[model samples]
Target: MGATPATRPTSTPRGLARVGDRVSFLYLERCVVSREDNAITATDDSGVRYIPSATIGVLLLGPGTRVTHQAMSVLGESGAGVVWVGEHGVRYYAGGRALTRSAGLVEAQATAWANRRHRLEVAREMYRLRFPDADPAGMTRRELLGGEGDRVKAAYRAEAARTGVRWVRRTYDPGDFAAGDTPNQAVTAAAQCLYGIAHSVVVALGCSPALGFVHSGHERSFVMDVADLYKVAFGIPAAFDAAAEGPEDIAGRTRRALRERIRAAGLLDRAVADIQHLLAPYRRADEEAAGGKAEDGTDGGVRLQTDRDGTVAGGRNYGAEGVW
Candidate 1:
């Protein structure tokens, strides 16, 4: 016989903390994840540890990790995204949903993307954030790309000089892990981690990951766009620091350094605010009219769309009114 209601686990995500207030992401491997009431139990040879599902923003499952259905269900209810990555975050396999139930932010994103002038303006704003000292207001897309390339190269050189690590051009082979040097491996690891974090934030805010201002023709273009804004400040330096420490276990060391940097910088909070700011002009005013808060939805409720940019109560017998 099936379990009774009182014995079943709670599936509602009500009263959970906001995603911006949680950890950026948690990386785990070589462990089994199982459900333990509201928290998840990670079991390994070292023993079991309980992690509150609602406190996680993103859970990165690296190679050798196994997760059960019950654990995933609780995570989904808590509005946490789950990303499956290769060892050292070399490749991304799949991703899960974020914490939002409303479509306000995505509508805003689509509106801005469909307009040429607004799209370019958003792209310029992104570049401005990347290079706070420069003005990208009047620059074209090509100009922005050129400037970004130059700045990135300069950042690489600066980090190498500061860390006393010999650096060359970035290189990576998807099939072969040892083709690149220690620095390249570290950089790749850092970039992948940043991508996971950005993906989680974008989805958490109900934004489309494919709608990008700077990048195009990729599924994760928007993720790339958002992650690049902090490459100079977070990813590169962390990678270089890990490489400087030692070449042994560069990927592990890089992840540790990057995690610390992300926490110290309060990256989750900053990312949430920056994204909202960039898409502020396009935010739908009707979001509030739909009976939800602008900052993440209220209770993840469902509503029906109506004509003239309006929303109505869902789960009704409207078919009798000829409005089916």
Candidate 2:
């Protein structure tokens, strides 16, 4: 006879911690991940270490990491994001679940994105957040793009001067990471890390990564927009600091430094607040216009679309209304 199987508990949204309250991300590699009741175990040459599944916001599976199906299922149930990345944050492969049950925020995003005026307003808000000293009001998209470019270039020069690293213009060859200097390598590594973090938050909030205001024509356009908001505060400084140490392991050092900076700054919490703020008006309009349908997406049920912004129950046959 076959042996009996162990029972696994299912996790619900209310049972898991909020995204802002959990760890930003945990990076693992060269280990086998498997489920152990409510926690996941990472086994390697060292030993087995158990991590609470519900406490993690994002899990970065680096090179050589092998995760079992049961482990992935548990992570999905806990609403934790999983991202497959390169050893030193050089590449990104794919992403896992959206970790949301309701479609309120995404609906709001789409509604605002569909209108040209609303889209431009959101873009201006993003720039306003980035450049608090300057006013982006009544600025055209072309002006916003120019100002952003100048600000970023100024940031690069400032970091280079502070760290005494040879500063050339930003250059990145995705096919060859080593072609760039130490600062460039570090910057790229830090940028990838920030992107991963931003993506996790975006998906968790039930927003579409492809629908972006400041950036467009990319699958991760919204992810890039969110990540750029923190580049000056976290990514650029961390990269320069790592490069100043030496080029021995610039990428690894950058990741570590960036992680520390993110944690110290409580960036996850701030990011959550900023995203909510950016979409608050749309969310309110959705709620008022759609009768409180724009909630935080913990309904755990699906709905069908009806005429005039109404929803009907899902998984039912409505064939009784005859008229072929």
Candidate 3:
């Protein structure tokens, strides 16, 4: 689901693909892409298009597209966007119609591979058992994450724990629960890492990022889902010691540093393994959501499972407007 680098659809896509780059996108119908010439063109197909990034206008995720109205309004308002990629190869526009207001979604089941007795599942299961009251869908993101501190501290107490005093700093970093991004690089970095891992997991499972157990929409979908179990693995100790916030000016800089840290952790790899195990469950969810198979075989081919990406792939069978 990633961009051209991690096999994402775009080329040179820190934000969007650059012109003269070879791109492979599936959700073209979700929006109108403005090319290099400032000419805007609406997309419609599950088909992959190699448009010069410069020639792209807005990447249109049109009416029949599964994007959200909030997203529609947002993207319609702004001319720029970022393509997001998860560990399992999820690649889609970060600010598209499906997740304009909500940002992005990675819908997948928590128990997609619950039956597996592997070490990863075992570890995840142990984490789940810690909070029996927690919902698989993430009914209480703020509440659950708020309580993660204690569980994180408990991990420090574990005899098997290889970490030491530094773990304490991570657990109690004041920077973790702040507003500004720059002032809290450590905490922000930890959160970004956790979210990146969670996003990757959702894509691999082929679930919708926007759907969650406790969460609904607009606040990042699968982020809440996997973050519940996945984020705690790293941040419990690291973010705990982070400063509450930094200067407002350096906020964006701090976020960049945070992204670097998250990327260095290689959490995406772990999520990929975990997500692949859940594929069977996600497929079932997809089927149920679609109310059986696609009338003309729309979903299940494109790996990202994003609203607009699905719309693009659907173009081959359905019309450019994503009609079946």
Candidate 4:
């Protein structure tokens, strides 16, 4: 379903937004003030708070997600790549919940990438198991992409198809970079930011990020579930951009540098914004179906008119949408 810590995120401060901090997760309906546990428990506007403020440090205010602490905790514990709730009722999905968190960023991203290599190896071995003549010393990311960098786009879509999930697809166009374009410094920088953003969402949504679509282990199945969606789409492009450009301009030359630079790059906020928007409708649906309320404190479920199948009439498609 996703990537593990080994999946190579584009961010530093491994597990950014880790546990033990206080949090303020603001949703369209209510604001949550609490501590960040494996799950970030929230205080509902109904004046019902299940978490203590001392454990909360992060104030996630914006058009993101709102979920029960119980749900958030699930994502956090599993090393989820991204986790979020709908406005109130639709869903509280946690991607990449089945991977390992043994290493920090450089190590983690390296591990994820290494694991990718190992996965290709294992695939080769599996093929050998059947064919008995498959090459064992062969396999490369280039081949994974059908020997063309452009094939990365297809690799992304094909992987997402496995989970019946669809995420937005993007290309790093010239429009993506204007004057002072960081192409010379983008790969590493972007990777780190992506990791941080991915893990943050994973924890919030209750998914473990250690497991993966291409790499699955028992340690972090849920985390893998989500991370896979971003690894190639977000992680690879970032890595390729910087790696493909001048490789000598940056100062620090370690993967940590890669992580830090990526972290420094902007757009985690935009990613968060996009994640929130994607989550809003689902959260609302889940909440309303269970009689959740809105910021106005009005019951939404009571008004929802559904067909016999329990699916809302004239409602936007939620489950059917796959990786974009």
Candidate 5:
């Protein structure tokens, strides 16, 4: 008989305390993922092994992983990002929802990103964080983009010199991974790893990855925006170091190195903090201006209170509270 949905636990799992603790996991092998007790377990040919769902940032379900609904519920509640990817983590197929229940953060994100002046300010802040020595306040959007491109090129050269890796043009064909040279492959792999990590944080923070300030239109625009901030610090150097190794399994090696670098840099936590920092100004302004007291007995915060007539209380509509 197949395993039925297990009873949801009342007490929180110990692993839940480890939320936002680790970076991500890539499940390359075929396995059956389920929930046992309060934890998640993966049963394969070897045996049943427990997976700490709460601590993991991204769960990359590559080929051959069958996840049960119960396991997914546990993961979702634990605030983990569940993603389906192709072999070697090349292509992204689908992603699950975030564990955060609050829509406040995402609403703030949309409000800031939708406003022209506010979006520009956020973009400038993002650029300023990456290049602290430079003042982006005086620069226009076009100028900022040009400056960032130039800085990235300089960073590539610096990494190449530091690692003694040959500096060549970045060439890659996503559909045909083998078409790229060793360094190019390494760079691509490192970048893919970073994207997965960044996406996990973006989802966990209850923000829309599709909505972005500096990067626009793409489904993972916000992911790209956040990942770019750490590319110079982590991805570039990792690719260079990996390229300096034996030609065999360069991508795998690069991924492993990138994982280590992510941990050392505390990237999972940093990504969450960065998103909050980038969107904080808007949230602060909204709170100060409109998120006043609610009839629900909350103060200096946004709360929804309704009367028996099914209308908002406190003599304030949703608009007055800036919640809409």
Candidate 6:
């Protein structure tokens, strides 16, 4: 009898759709990841082990990890984000695309962001959610920014006092991590960690990380915005605690502590919910308009409508323009 050839798996593992699903972050150093038996396998100095790619939110590739083309393909298909970081996962260099293909949420995000008034409304909504005890209804963009800054300052001071970590000021040079003071470095590391987590969730939810309400310009502006919303609750405390531990292995310590805090607070699901809530007003408005039109017997076949500037009105025309 002739020898049989090895065959690839017919299907890849499906990623999590809902935010409540259990997803984990895998950090590997000096390892090679490859596809084996329909699962992602990582080979390091120890041995080879399977990685549940579908349930992974982000794969943090630090230092000497080599990823095969097949492994990358599987991860891409599974909607898992691959982030390249520096030693100890302190610096984020690049990332892969989100696995979600839904255009409805993306369209709604663009529509809301493209309009100035709607964008302000979304910003206000974010502020309200972040500070539920206070009212941001009458606040302007500048006022909101001021309030947020004050709140963040207070959070840093509070966390410093709680953790017994000295607080002088927040100063850090991203290019040179060592130049910053201990607390600064810890804060930066913690924020970066939160940003990575937030980015994974944002991508998984099928939303644009570029289009942001309070933040703009950067590629991961939306990610920063979302992460900022929860920083007072997670990042600040994690940084302070890590700083209190002294400078020995600060990066690794901060990462581990932040991960524990995130898990304990159910941060992933909260992030997903916050994204949905931030975009909910726009989604609700569209649904209500559609419903109202339907009730008035004006249910014409959906057609592309544009304003004077050629911006898509009543949500994007996904068929003609493609998802933004």
lDDT of each: 0.83, 0.81, 0.38, 0.37, 0.74, 0.73
Judge candidate 6 at residue 69 and give its lDDT: 84
Per-model TM-score versus the true fold:
0.88, 0.87, 0.37, 0.28, 0.81, 0.81
Per-residue lDDT of candidate 5, residues 1-324 (tens digit):
544445444323332544356646554458888887556888889999887666677776756889888888777777666766554427774354555444556877998998999899889999988888989997899999999999999988998898888878888776877778788888887887778778877876678998888999999999889988888889989998999885688877888888888878787777778888888776634343444334453433334444431223344445555532
RMSD of each: 3.4, 3.8, 14.3, 19.9, 5.1, 6.6
Worst 10 residues of 3 by lDDT: 96-105
Candidate 3 displacement at residue 75 in angstroms: 12
Model 2: clashing residue pairs? none
Q: State the displacement of the C-alpha of residue 273, model 2, in Å, after optimal TM-score superposition.
A: 1.0
Error of 3 at 82 (Å): 3.6
Best-fitting candidate, measured by TM-score?
Answer: 1
> What TM-score does structure 2 among the candidates reach?
0.87
Model 1 residue 35 CA deviation (Å) reads 1.4
Candidate with the greatest lDDT versus the true structure: 1
Stretches of candidate 5 above 4 Å error? 1-6, 9-15, 24-27, 30-32, 43-45, 63-66, 87-89, 284-302, 305-324
Instruction: Give the alpha carbon lDDT tens digit for every residue of 151-206 in model 4.
Output: 44665455445433343554343322222223323433333334444555544433
Per-residue lDDT tens digits of candidate 6, residues 1-324? Answer: 322113444231232344446454667778998986446899988899997667677787877889888788766656667777674325664354544433446667898999999999999988988888879987899999999999989998988888888899888775777788788888887787777777887877778889999999999888888888888888888888999999987877887888888778788788877887777666635444554233334422233434432223343335645532
Off by over 4 Å in 2: 1-9, 87-89, 98-100, 284-324
Q: Which is the winner by TM-score between candidate 4 and candidate 5?
A: 5
At residue 154, what lDDT does model 4 achieve?
Answer: 62
CA lDDT, candidate 1, residue 88: 34
- Give the runs in model 1 whose Cα sits over 4 Å from its true position: 1-14, 288-291, 294-324
Better candidate number, 1 or 3, judged by lDDT: 1
Model 2 over residues 1-324: C-alpha lDDT tens digits?
Answer: 422124444555567788888788888989999987778999999999999987887787878999998888778777677877674336674454555566667777887888999999999999988889989999999999999999999999999999998888899888788888889998988888888889888887778989999899999888899999999889999999999999997877888898888888899999988887788778634343544332334443566666556665556667857222
Global local distance difference test of model 5: 0.74
